[model samples]
Target: MQKDEQRNIILAIVLSLAILLGFNFLTAPSEEELAAQRAAFEAEQAQLAEDANSGDPSTPQLDSTLSAIENAAAGLTAPLDRSEALDQTPRIAIRTPKLEGSISLRGGRIDDLTLSTFFETIQTDSPNITLLSPVGSLAPYYAEFGWISSDSSIAVPDSKTVWSSTVDTLTPSQPVTLFWENGSGLRFEREISVDENFLFSVKQRVINNGSSATELAPYSLISRTGTPELLGFYILHEGPIGVLDNSLVEVDYDDLQDEKLIQNRTTGGWLGITDQYWLTALIPDQEQSVQTRFVYTGKGNTTRYQTDYFYDPVAVSAGETVTFDSNVFLGAKEVTLIDDYQEELNITDFDLAVDFGWFYYITKPMFFALHWITGVVGNVGVAILILTLAIKIPLFPLANKSYASMAKMRKLTPKMTALRERFGDDKQKLNQEMMNLYRQEKVNPAAGCLPILIQIPIFFSLYKVLFVTLEMRQAPFFGWIQDLSAPDPTSIINGFGLLPWDVPELGILGFINLGVWPILMGLSMFLQQRLNPQPTDPVQAKVFMLMPFFFTFLLATFPAGLVIYWTWNNLLSIIQQALIMKKAGVPLGRQPDEA
Candidate 1:
């Protein structure tokens, strides 16, 4: 009977600790923290606008050019292109024979006709025009530019131009001169500087030798026509500072139900399209300011447009040369490289949160400050360890107080047990007696639960910080954990590729391919629980042990960062509990009440 009673006491202590750990792990943020974060974001945006407008040279030019472009677009008629005709067969189709290569130029507009495809990287080596179009099994078609015409009717000429490495020999910063004489006695001669960076700036001098002011409307427009499915996802942005259209749709083969585009409107930002595997950002030069509009063409010839104002329209006089220059950024979403360029592009917003309370506000700043520091530390895993230790040390006093409360409660458990036996089945009388006894001893039954309640939110807020924030998306932790956003790299049922447990292939189960880390996490949790106090009741002991297994299964598909945080937290709890036990003069094997 004594052994059974001792076992129950231990089990109760362990259960209390487990409950505290779980709660603390989940509640790191309060409502006030969230409100503060929102306020901070708004203030930052206001400051950015003020700085951008102060001593700004691009404003006047941008306002003027935007007016001109809008006026010109309003007056223009649809071109007689083959694709525009309702009766004509789809004869004109854009083909991308090669989807890879670089272009010449650092920062300037190039005529769309000069390039083979729209999706080309700008690099010093292999400085030739390349475009991105679905040729073999890919979807959607979009083009980048070295030069674009202001006149929309001038269709891009379809010509087989062999752009080879020989052209790469030409210095990107060098000048290229071109002369053309049409049958109409109109001579077009221009000398443009091709920067060593692969961008070209052209000053077009059109000599209308044939009398009267030429009434030709000059503009540039990129056109596309194809089955909607053939174009997986298409998004067009007018400039760096623009709002995307919400009507953009994602083509899903299985469901045939289109996915809606999520639009965000705030300060200037980049455009990202997942199905296209492409991201484009506008890089504006001081000489030419730019704004952006997002265009989405959906199935059944439906079109959606959202415009953001940046600059005014530009006009060129007849018999005179006018210059318009802007930079274009075309590439994949490489987080580190993209961030480096984003600073140069004057982009400031990058998501990185730590928690959702005062701690979150404090931690968010630290995360940003330590970003470069953490990156240099060789591994993000080590960075997390350092950050955890830094936080825990400061809160050590509170933690110690909570532990002391629990030790005091453990000392009074024997008297409580005696009261239970003395008034067996007399619930009302037993409660009165227990309360009187607690009062006499100056003990509070709830004191032990306070530390746990306080820490629960902090733990949860940290989980949110590590999981949802974009800063940690592609961050590398330790070996094999290449991307913190993804699950750890370990699979149990390998080779045959069979689904585990014969569960239905849907929802969460369908997505979880790796299950090794979760198992290890469960094992660690079980060990941690074993090291703490055990429950006396068989049912309660079973519940305590089974929790680790339940958590392991629940976390099987979570991001590696989340798992790392939980595992470390459990380890810390074990250490803290051991320290408290030693300080209270409780022997490892002896019952606390007996002492």
Candidate 2:
């Protein structure tokens, strides 16, 4: 009977597979059709560009393409290469141990910078990760500091204003001081200082040279010319984020665009725009009060997102000078760096910039523990293994108890089967007998679920750590496993990148890019399942059998580090279950059912 039951289950699986394959075969698009669509789209874009250039209002209206949308968000009629845009502006060199770039002197903008330690790809010769670019660039993003005043008589330096720099390069020891006179009796001085890492100190000082006193409000702004490409997942926040009065506030770009503007008044706090891995923030003086605002200017495809703050107005009389001090943060979101800055600068809740998700309590600890382990072991992959063992050690006692109970339940399955047969149509009687049997045998069927329930939060927290932390960016794990925060580069298709051709990361089909780690995870889960007794219900058995396969596909696109954890965890569970089941003396075999 058991053999027959197995055969029937196998047949059902085969039928399901056949149906799935048939659907794929029917829906797959042909090469000709794909090429035709691409050609038509390109032709339409060319015509639109031609019409716009010729000033033809009668041109056919067209919906926006992704590139078009990005350009529109940037307030650019057309996208220009970033290098070209940066070349148009005069710049002062900025050099540090961890960063290399030139700050634009024309707008006094730190808009051309890249991380010295990070790269665009795994290749050693790849370019560094560009953090900011000039305004005329394809996707212009920058940070600027100046004064905003209600009084029109006072002239303040703006985006078009040109400043003369005393120094050629800004470094940790040498700061660049810029001078700009509005020709309206005001002499403006900006002294820009940078640390070896990513923090910039900008001191804005104004001297009222004219006879009348001037009231000007000092302000700092970090603006992204276009709506950036977002990860668009709920787990990650990629837009305007800030700490207002000790409270963390995060709003998506779409939300800000819809709401138009959000404002708050606080004595002091930090505000900024955060990408998945990078950040650009304006840190105001903690001792002084300021007005903060997150604003979005939406005009067609060209839009702008600005996170800005204004310090209380300063009244400077003739021959008197007032200074406004602030910090500009632009670089990779390194935890240790941010923590140091927070401590040194006393920025309130600055570390909250990294979205630890709702499970911050768990995720933060998980990251710190892993980070510590990595420091000790010197390899992130080995550290993950050690961390998994550390976590399992504490839960060992609970897991042992759960497995012992599961083994006992397997041993009692024979008696339970007999009760089911005896009570054929009497479901109530069968349940009663099963309960009495469980009580007598001291077997708790729910015991096995406790460990799994406890693991849910742990899994989510670890997943969050792997997904968002900069410490894990480009972290290597043995061969072919570079960049733990990214999806596995190798795929089952194309001979794991050995083939000359590439696979299309199509919408739903992207899930099929299973790597070596995810496959091992699926196999480990299957072996682990064998330690437990098969369910009496056929439907339940099928679910248990298919769970590993379902998870294999589902997690293929997740970060490689997260998938490695699951694989390692499954192997550990299998070993632990084996030991517990053997200790319980639960005989392993095909236990027969009553007929």
Candidate 3:
């Protein structure tokens, strides 16, 4: 027993040391080799360019074919845009064409504005405001402020002051102010600021010099590319409780590769907004007092409008100043940090609680706790190891009892074999006798499976953490393993320059390559299983032994972090099993001695 325990401890230490060394080796790259590789790639690209320009018919044709394939692939993956208004029948314009308010600001004729024309006008020199359009191509176009208004009657003292065709220099630090005076002796002033680094703000100040103290409900009309149809705009809210994107809830997935956007709407409640391609608005609300409406117009000759109303609106009192602030995020979904911020803009029928439910109530807090501990350790890999140890320690007593129960079962195996032989054709009677014997001995037949059952959830949760958590994304372990979020680094066949299969030419390898991690993972699984007690049922044991191979195939396409976690788990399990067996006074042999 002492010898077995000592052996288990030694094995555990050795395995841990080996994993650390492997990680170190994977992260460090030889500077000379990297420099040489970069130079070679540059030279190859230059050569390819020169060849393509040499008027070689075959080369040009090949390039065209490749380009077409790439475009087709991109089109397949890109989301469909739903902001065009051309699909629906035209309705009467909601606002009046002519201005009749206390303050007369610039107004325009609806007929003179084509989507293209409006976009063009903004493209001209405008410093205060910009116009963005979604036409000609998918790329976004920015337009500067211009002198012309929809109503040509309103003239500014200086056209140059009204608009500048250059990029707006107004930043969050210093804002631009606009003042307008109408025939009714009403004056309107607003401050606006926008910066390259996502900062947009607007403040409106209205003053009524008229003796009647005329009341005016203020509204501004600004054209944007991806506005929601119903409210003629989108609303995004941020608050201390949580962020709401058009009010939609967020979800997490075990495998991002398996994720698909599934739309579900609830009846008799806010259906919440769904964005086909682009998100349009962000609003910050501190209290239930905020009320806003979002209207969207679809793109491309189809004029469809959708409206959303927020009843519990955050309000601004008359003659009282209130500030609405929120950070707006726009970009790709795969970029998680940015996307998380953008998610606040989505609207959903149901409110999302920070704690998802009892499940989240438990898991999220635990996740944070584990995250803190791991982060303090400096290396996430080491943190994971420590977490694994922490989990295993709590299960030690249960696992130890299970092992003892299994030892008793092992002692009875010879007697069971004799009984089986005696009742070769009387299986029912043999089973009844075996049950009676187990009851008399106070042994639970399922005891051997307990440890495995108990460990499954922890194992799966670890898998989720390693694969889905942002912490592991692009994290480094050791030499060659530059990105834990990707497959291990390895050549197709040692010296083969080409990978075994064709993959998109991105990243360092130019193809999806499975590195040494999966291979090591499989080996560890096999070793752990070999060291475990053989099942009394030979067929079951054989099936169990094949699991390592199955896992190897499944893991080949998974992130390296997952493979590393599983490999370490198996190594630890082997150590635990050895210790358990030692405590049971069991010898390392194919079969146990009869009781």
Candidate 4:
């Protein structure tokens, strides 16, 4: 019977694979068909872009003046190469230990910046990761700071205004001060300072030297032209995000497209656009109330996403100077650095920018634990192993109880089978006898589920840590696992690199290409299942038997670190369960039905 069951399970899997492979082969496109599909896809994309550019009738339109200002601010004209865009404007070199870039002087925009420590790829000579780019670039992303006035005649520094800088280069010790006179007795001074890290402080000061007093409001914005490719996972937010009125506001790019504009009023909060590992946020004065907005605009193939804050208008008396202090964060979202900035800079909920997900409580502690372990052990992979052991230790007593219960239930299988035979063809009587048996033996059939239930949150939290945290990005494990945050690069289709040919892209069926680590994980899961009591029903037993194979394919696309954790966790569970079952005098290998 056992051999027959094993044969049935293997046959089912082989048949499933055969059907999938046959379908894939039958549906495969020829060269001409592929070219035609590509052309159709291109045309569809162009039409979508045209539809986006064509304004929606229901969506409110901005006035011509504001529209012009936005278009100019975003440099929504014809796109140019990044190099050409950077050369078109005069810039002050930004020199720091961790950053290498320049600040454009024409618009006083903090653009054209790159991370000195990070690269576009793992290759040796890859270019640095460019965080900000100037206007006219294919994808313009930048931060701009200045003042706005209700008085139409009042001239304020804008995107077209050219300001003189006090220094040719900006460094940690040397700040750059930009000066711009409106030719109307108003002198605007912007002092920009940076630290050794990602934080930048910008002090906007205006001197009212005119005969009449005027009111000016300071505004700062971070804008990106063109929609960026998103990770598209619901677990992490990757578009417009902010903390407003002490509440976190996350709006997806598509959501903003439908809503058009989102407005809120807050005191001392931050607003910005975020990617998986990087962020660009504007921090307004904590003591002052400001109106914040997340806006979206589309033109031709170009789209603009912006997050900005407008401080309450301040009246500057004649001969009096008013200063507004704010800050902009542009760089990698380092967990420790972000936490420190939150504490030191008094930014509210700044750590939320890291997207710890709903399990922030569990996920954050897990990350800190793993981070600390890595610091001591000097390898993130080793840290993961140690952290898993530590977690197991704390849950040891509960798991032991669950395993003991399962062992006792397995030992009572003989009595259960007799009860089923005695109550043959009577489902109700069989259930009654099973309940009475459980009561007499003082063994709970559901107790074995406790360990699995507990693991649900732990599993989700660890998955969140692996998916959202920047520290795990590009982190290396032993062997071919150079990026813990990415999927395993080696596939069985390529004989795990034994063959020179690469795996062909199979669209939705790409998960069929199993990696070495995932296969090991699936095997461990299967072995671990052998020690547990099998389901009595044949159909359920078959489904349970297939779970390992199902998970192997499901988790192939997950981060390598997560797959390693699961594999190690399954092995540990196997060892622990084996010992517990042996101590309980429960047979380890034989199924109750087979016995």
Name the runs in model 4 displaced over 4 angstroms. 1-70, 73-78
> Over 4 Å off in model 1, which ranges?
1-100, 103-137, 141-278, 283-292, 299-312, 319-321, 332-344, 348-374, 419-485, 491-507, 510-516, 530-543, 587-595
TM-score of each candidate structure, all chains considered together: 0.54, 0.86, 0.53, 0.88
Q: Write the per-residue lDDT of candidate 4 for residues 426-527, one digit (tens) a residue.
A: 877777777777778777666666666666667677778887888888889999999888778889999999999997775556667789999998999899
Query: For model 2, what is the alpha-carbon lDDT of residue 457?
Result: 69
Using lDDT, give the best candidate's number. Answer: 4
TM-score for candidate 3, please give it. Answer: 0.53
lDDT of 1 by residue, 65-165 (tens): 34221101111132222122212111111112322322222111121222333223322353443222211111212322222234444221111111212
> Candidate 2: where is the Cα deviation over 4 Å?
1-80, 497-501, 589-595
Cα deviation of 530 in candidate 4 (Å)?
0.7
- Indicate whether candidate 2 or candidate 3 has the larger TM-score: 2
